[model samples]
Target: MKAVVVNEGGALSIQNIEMPKITSPDQILVKVAYCGLCGSDIPRIFHHGAHFYPITLGHEFSGTVVDTGHGVTEFDNGDLICCVPLLPCFKCDECQKHYYSLCKNYTFVGSRIAGGFAEYIVLDKKNAFKLPKGISPLEGAFFEPMTVGMHALLLADGCEGKNVVIVGGGTIGLLAMQCAKAMGAKSVAVIDINQQRLDLAKKLGADAVYHSQKLSSEAIHQALSSSRFDQVVLETAGSPVTVNLSIEIAGPRAKIALVGTLHHDITLPEKTFGLILRKELQILGSWMNYSAPWPGKEWQLVSQYFIDGKIKLDELIAGMGDFDSFIKQVTALNGRPMNGKILLNCM
Candidate 1:
């Protein structure tokens, strides 16, 4: 099978490798259909080198079940499925507490195990969920990222009747806006350095959009003086500038959730300490979900929403190209601006 392998930092090559074998009875083999290149995967593959090379690097994907193990009764051949990507040791203390993300022995699909970037990938039958009826495999590839947004909104407390602000207008940031609105936020605003992305956000569901370059701290304060955001969510993984700005614009006692990642050190302003102490703000850091909020709710909530048209997953697709062309497109966007998510059609 042909697969893209990163042998080292700043290196990626497409090569023919042996297909992965099902080594365990609880595993199911899936033939890759489509995989989305997430922002985190790009940096981890090329920048910090956290992704071990000679291994597949895509985690956000969906495929059809080719075969199932002896004990696999829940799924069968021809059934399409998407997984949580986290394979946790169910006996661990954190798993016992239903916090699989914090499990000491947690293993993610793309990072710790062979991921979905190849023609075939194996997943624990326990972690895979059947793709709901009428959900396309392409849209199924987005379930992982959507779950991240769902987790962030849950971590932000409740969005009901609250004014919310989301920093960054990328895929994750835009998805976060939709999640906030679904949770009943009265008004939602998305801010980004890219005008193109902010425009896309408005088209999706953002009630208002602002370009970071056009708005300074004073401008933000003036805009919010009449209606300050009760919840602020940050999905820009670029720098800490937006994180601190989220802090600055938050209403008194507002909740702030950081959903994006920063590779470099983040510094908070000196006044932030005073603001935190005086305003009683609650700041929370969020990441990929652990898959434990409700029974089968992970895919069901998101799948139903997309299937029923509550969220516009179609508009989120920015670019789609063949294998080689797709890779070039991703690498080219390294320092350029992106208005939406990019996908690769491996079939």
Candidate 2:
């Protein structure tokens, strides 16, 4: 099996590795067909020494089942499936409380464990979801990120009849916007410094889009004051500036969800405390979809959203280049299209 591995920090290479074998009754082996390169993968590969050297590096993916262990009943060989990627000890207190995403022993594919940047990977039956008939494998590859948005919305409660503002126009941010709209936000606004992403956001149903760089702090304040959105969603990778900017624009009594990974420390405004205290704002953090129901039910939720036209999945795809080319193209971030998710076909 050929897999892309990061030998060490700042080192990446393709090597022939032995295929993973399934030894547990609850495990299933998937022959990967497509995988999406998430922005986090780059930092893990280049900056953080999180992954063991020579480990595969991909988490968001979809494929067909090549084999299943003795007790597997939900799926058989040849079924299309997507993985949740988070491996958890199902007997833990967190798991018992339906907070598997917060399990102390949680591990994810392509990060702390073997992953989908390879020809085959073995996953627990609980982590693999069967794809719906109408969805293509390429689109199915997006289920992981979409599930992140779904999980974030779940944390924020219902979006019905509320004005929602998403800070950042990246893949997660854009996906969150679509999900917020589908959940029935009265209006959805996306903020980004890039016009291309804003245009893409418009195509995907953002009610209003703004160029963050061009707007002065007063202008930003004026804009927020005018819209007065009750819900603020952050998926822009928690860049410090964006974090404070998000807090600055939030309306009174607003609910804010943090779906982005803050790479560096950010300076927050003292007024942020005033808003939280005076307005009773809610701050929530969401991680990957690792809890509840089986992986099949979760993937079905994403698939249903796609089938029912709640999310514009296809429009978010920036390119369909080959797997290797996609790695090169997507890894180099430009201001524009940084907000869109790119897919790579491994088959």
Candidate 3:
């Protein structure tokens, strides 16, 4: 098997490696099919290092089951599946409360262990799910990110029957928009620094789009036909600018979910901080999902939506290539602007 290995110095090299085998009775071995490149992968590959040197990093992926342990009854050979990356110790306090993401003893695929960038990866049967009928392997790869969006929307208090604003048009941001609409948002406006992404956002059900460079309260009001987004605002850009702007774009008493991650210290702007007080907004910081309502509802909901034809992710796919192309594309992702998700055909 071959995988793009991130060496200790953050250099990416495609190298032949031993294939992972089922190490536990509850585990399943899968043949990697399509893996999507995440924005976080950019820094993890070029700047921040992985959990260990020579690790393969790809969490948003889907594949066919090559073999399943005898204990696995739900899935069998050749069934398409995607998995929630978090592997929680069910005995922890957080896990007892079904908040797996907050579990103290959680491990992650593609981060803490070997992942989908390779020709084969192993997943605990509990973490793997068979893709619903009518969903292709590529669309199956969307399950993870859609779950993130679903979790963020839940943090924003459901998005039902109210206008919303999403402050980023990247993959996560766009998925958040779809989740909002699916949850019955009255309308949505997506703001981004990249016009190309904003255009893509509009094509994928964003009612309106704005470039952050020229955004203003009045401009956003005009776009959504309201003084502010009274329902919810999800900040997926994770910069000081977008997070603050989510505050500015929110209406009085609105709930704001900060979903993006900022890697460094941020000096909070005075005016934005004051707005929180004046508006009496409920500002919440959302992290990885609790996987609640039902175990893995995030994955189930996204899967059913795709199965029912309520959602289609064709527009989010920008390109497809082999392992080498994935490396080149991801290397340039952070510093450049691209509008869609790039998938690597791992065969």
Candidate 4:
């Protein structure tokens, strides 16, 4: 089998590696179909952020089951599935409490072990989720990011009948906007530095879009006809600026979910810090997408929404190609402004 391997010092190559086989009774061997490139992949591939060298980095992927071990009863050959990349130790205290995402000992697929950037891979039965009939392999590949947005919403206690503000227009941010609308938010507003993403947000049903570069925080409030968002504010940009903006624009007692991965230190201004006390805000720190019963409701809901046509993914795909094209795309990541998801067809 051929797999894309990231060697030490950030060099990538497509090499022939031995095919992974099912070694556990609760495992399944899958033929890779599609894999979505995540924003985090950029750092791991180019910035030496990987846990180890010679890694195959891809977590958001979908595939077809070719064989299942005897212990796997829920899935069989020919099943279309999307993977839950977290491999949690079921014996840990966090795992005992059904907090799989917070498990003290956890290994991720793309980061800690072999991932789905190849022709085939093996997955534990617990990590493989079957896709519904209407969802395509490309759409199935989106399940991971879609679940991420849904996980943030769940942490904020959902968005129904509330004014929601998402402070990013990347794939996760845009998906959160659509999920908010699908869950019956009164209004959904998206803020971003990128005009292309803002436009894409509007096309996907955002009630309003704001270019962060052009609008002052005051102006954004005025445009929305509100002093601040009263219900929910999701900070998904993972930047210091957007983090503070989420604090600035949140109304009293608003449930604010921090969904993005922060790479820099953030020191809140005195006024910003004071708002938390004065407004009695609910600050929720969202982690990876997982809950009780293994992969949890986030995955189930995302799969159902995709089947029901409540979410749109085609517009979020900025590029798609095979392995050679994937190599070129990876090379182009430096100094490039990526506004959408890039996909690789592994088979």
Per-model TM-score on C-alpha atoms: 0.93, 0.91, 0.93, 0.97
Off by over 4 Å in 1: 293-298, 334-339
Minimum summed lDDT over a 10-residue window in model 1 is located at 290-299
CA deviation > 4 Å runs, candidate 4:
225-230, 335-337
The C-alpha RMSD in Å for every predicted model, in order, reads 2.1, 2.5, 2.0, 1.4
lDDT of 4 by residue, 115-207 (tens): 999999999887788988988998889889888889989888888888999999999999889888888899999999889888888899998
In Å, residue 200's CA in model 4 sits off its true spot by 1.1
- Which residue pairs in candidate 4 collide? none
lDDT of 2 by residue, 1-347 (tens): 87777666455566778888999998999999888878777666666655467667788899999899998998989899887788788788987887888889877777888878777899988777787787778777888887777777777775778878888888888887887777788888888887888999999999988788988645765776756756655555577777777667777778778888876777667886676777677888887764566552345667877778687777777676665666566556532224456666778
Best by lDDT: 4
TM-score of 2: 0.91
lDDT of 1 by residue, 1-347 (tens): 87777666556677788887778888898998888877777766666555465667888888999998887888989998876787778888878887766778877888887777778888888667788789888878888888787776777766788888888788877877787777788888888888878888888888888777888856875676656646555555457787777777777887877787786798887896677777688888775675565323445678877777777777788887666877687777763445577777877
Which 10 residues in a row give candidate 3 its minimum summed lDDT? 221-230
lDDT for model 2, please. Answer: 0.76
> How much lDDT does each candidate structure score?
0.76, 0.76, 0.80, 0.87
lDDT by residue for model 3 (1-347), tens: 88978876557789988888887888999998888877777666766657677778888889999898888998989899986677888988888888787888878888898778878888998777788778988888888888887887876668788888888888899888988888788998889988888888888888888887976865664565573545788888888878777777778888888899997777768887899999899988887755764346777778777877767587788887898887777665643535688888975
Give the C-alpha miss distance for residue 1 in model 1, angstroms. Answer: 1.7
Q: Which pairs clash in the backbone of model 3? A: none
> Clash number for every model?
0, 1, 0, 0
Candidate 3 residues lying further than 4 Å off, grouped into runs, are 218-230, 293-295, 332-339
Question: Candidate 4: lDDT of 284?
Answer: 92
